[model samples]
Target: MAVNIQKGLAAAGLAPLHVWNRTASKAEPVQAEGAIVEPSLESLASKCSLIFAMTFDDAALESAFSAISALSNKSKETENKILVTCSTVAPSLVQQLEHKTKSVSVLSAPVFGRPDAAAAKMLVAVLAGGSETEKNLVAKYLEYTTRKITRLGGPAHTANVLKLTGNFCILSVIEMLAQAQTLAEKNGVPREAVVDVVSALMPGPIVTGYSERIARDEFDVGFTVDGGLKDVGLMRDLASSSSVSLPFADIAHGHLERQKAENKDLDWASLAKIVRKDSHL
Candidate 1:
């Protein structure tokens, strides 16, 4: 995200010269590239036009907010502050985050795309907030960094809902690919052959990538196995809250759990590995 912002900032001549992270050492690379490293999250929050929390889950989101809340309590005067959350979390939790940040304007602005896409300034930022003023301000701020910007409803959760929905679709595709590869490998057909056929007919990059991962067992460091499990877990929770029976989600959730139990460090795409291995591929 920092890299993405850097590229966008340079393009817009709004270069970010100051930044911070949970791991102070992680901020070194950016600092080396002409960005000032802030002493603390509080200091960082006070300095920036907008502070983005691109954390993993609801728990992480709450922890960041806890820090911000502590800081807000210390200062009597508050200026133009916006907490742009770029994390994939439940909408309800985002509302809680918004309510918790008393002085700062909270906006749900989850972004789509991986680190590489972000580095290229091609991320899709989805913005949603009750405050149109804040939302518009965030949209403009995001425009300085991302290629595409989507504005959602008049609530902070809208962007999070969109992000979760998109993740569900991605998980669905991965689950299907896993089963398909399992079926293909069980028969005389090779997984690659099946993938090639599917790629030619369907032609989605995600499916194509997962197909290769399943075939070659190449679930690496990108999007780890634990993360996949967490996402599937979130999908199940969301489906349950909506009173929807998603059998496929259940199966996917189980697959993720099994993968975690076996090889916790595997990449998320490695969910396909579980199905393939179970079928003796």
Candidate 2:
């Protein structure tokens, strides 16, 4: 994802990027693509005015923010720096980060898309910041990395909330597709035939692409079951805090947990197998 983001940025004439990764070997590919590899997070933070931290979870996001904050405390030049967090995290985490760092502007810009979509520069970016100026400044650079940008306004956490909810919707759709396909297959209908009918009715990438994958049993890791479980857990927490209930989320969570128990490394699409197994297919 980082490589694709850098490639898109370079394609949009935003080259000469300073790249760094915790694993030095992983940064090699980005360096080969013409990005100047930085030795450390502190070095990258010191040199770049606009830094993007795309980590796996909130814990990693907090560590990245800590490095940036330490640099900000030591250098006056860091005041105007912009920190764009592209990781999927809870809205409350973003709020806490904002409160902790008053020097640099924090823009919560969680993205939506699989790796292929990101490589094609077709990812949808949901952005929120403290001001329009900050958002515009970040969006101008991010345009190269995404097909469309949805600005959610001044509150930084709004974009995080949107990301979590949007992911929940995707998981719900996956669960629906899994069960529907299972039902069709058990009734002497071919999985492909069922997917074809749904594709004709729905006609969207999510439906067409994922349904086809489920039909083919192509559960390669675009997004892992564990990753889906993490996001769904976050959604459940968000709903609980707001005195709301997401029954579908609970269902999806259970399916993902079952999938994880059986095969710990399969993609989230493997949730389809739960339906198939339940039907004794």
Candidate 3:
């Protein structure tokens, strides 16, 4: 994701790109696109005016923040830095980071897209936090990487909450597609028949893509069952806190758990296997 973001930036004729990754080798690809791969965190912090982090989870995001905070704001660049995080973490974590990063402005700029979308610069970005000038700076660059940028214009954590909510809706569609395809197969109907109906009705890339994945039995790539379980847990916890009922998520959780127990590394679309078993297919 970081590599592609830089590619978009470079392609759009943006200024000299600076990047730092935990793994030195992983940052090399972007160097071909005119990005300077910094060796240490301090070098990155000192050089970049707007730093965008693409950490995987809360622990990783917090660890990166801690390392930067330990830097003691030595550089003048650090004193006037904008930290825009694109991690899919809890809103509370974003809120905490805002309070903790006394000098730097933190923006919750989570995005909705798979790796393919990111590579193609078609990501949907949701941004919040910072003053109008700060957000505009981040969003201005984000325009190169994302198809649309929705500035929520509130507490920095608002974007994180909305990101999780959007993720839940996406997972719901995958879970539903898995069930629908399995049902069609069990009823002596060709899976393609159901796929055809879904394509004609929904017409969105996600709906059509997953429907075809199910029909083609292509469940070996992309998001795994373990990943689905993690998102499911996040959504369930969010729903519980809000006194909302997500019965479908409860059902998908059970299916994902069963798949995880089998120790099979399958894509999320393979959750249909559990549904197939229940129907005795």
Residue-level lDDT tens digits of model 1 in 1-281? 67556655666787765787877898887776667789987787667657778786888888777767666667665454677888888777887767765576788888877777767667788888857877776787677557898887767887887887787887888889888878877887888898899899889567787777767878776777788777777777777888988788788777888888878888877777677677776
Q: Between prediction 1 and prediction 3, which has the larger TM-score?
A: 3
User: Would you list the C-alpha lDDT of every candidate in the order shown?
Assistant: 0.76, 0.86, 0.82
**Best-performing candidate as measured by lDDT:** 2
Q: How well is each residue in 122-233 modelled by candidate 3, as lDDT tens digits? A: 8999999999989988888787768998889688989988988888777778789877887888788898999999999999888898889878878889888887887788
Best candidate according to TM-score: 2
C-alpha TM-scores of all predictions: 0.90, 0.95, 0.93
By TM-score, the better pick of 1 and 2 is: 2
Instruction: Name the lDDT value of residue 24 in candidate 3.
Output: 85
Question: Could you report the Cα RMSD, in angstroms, for every candidate shown?
Answer: 2.2, 1.6, 1.8
lDDT of 2 by residue, 1-281 (tens): 66765776687787878988888998888888888899999999999988888888899989988888899889897766778999889888898888786777888899988778877778899999867887888887777658999998668888999999889888888999999988888898898998899999999898898999999999985888888888988899899999998999998888889999988578898988887888898
Worst 10 residues of 2 by lDDT: 1-10
State residue 268's C-alpha deviation in candidate 1, in Å: 1.6
Give lDDT: candidate 2, residue 267. 84
Global lDDT of model 1: 0.76
Q: Supply the TM-score for candidate 2.
A: 0.95
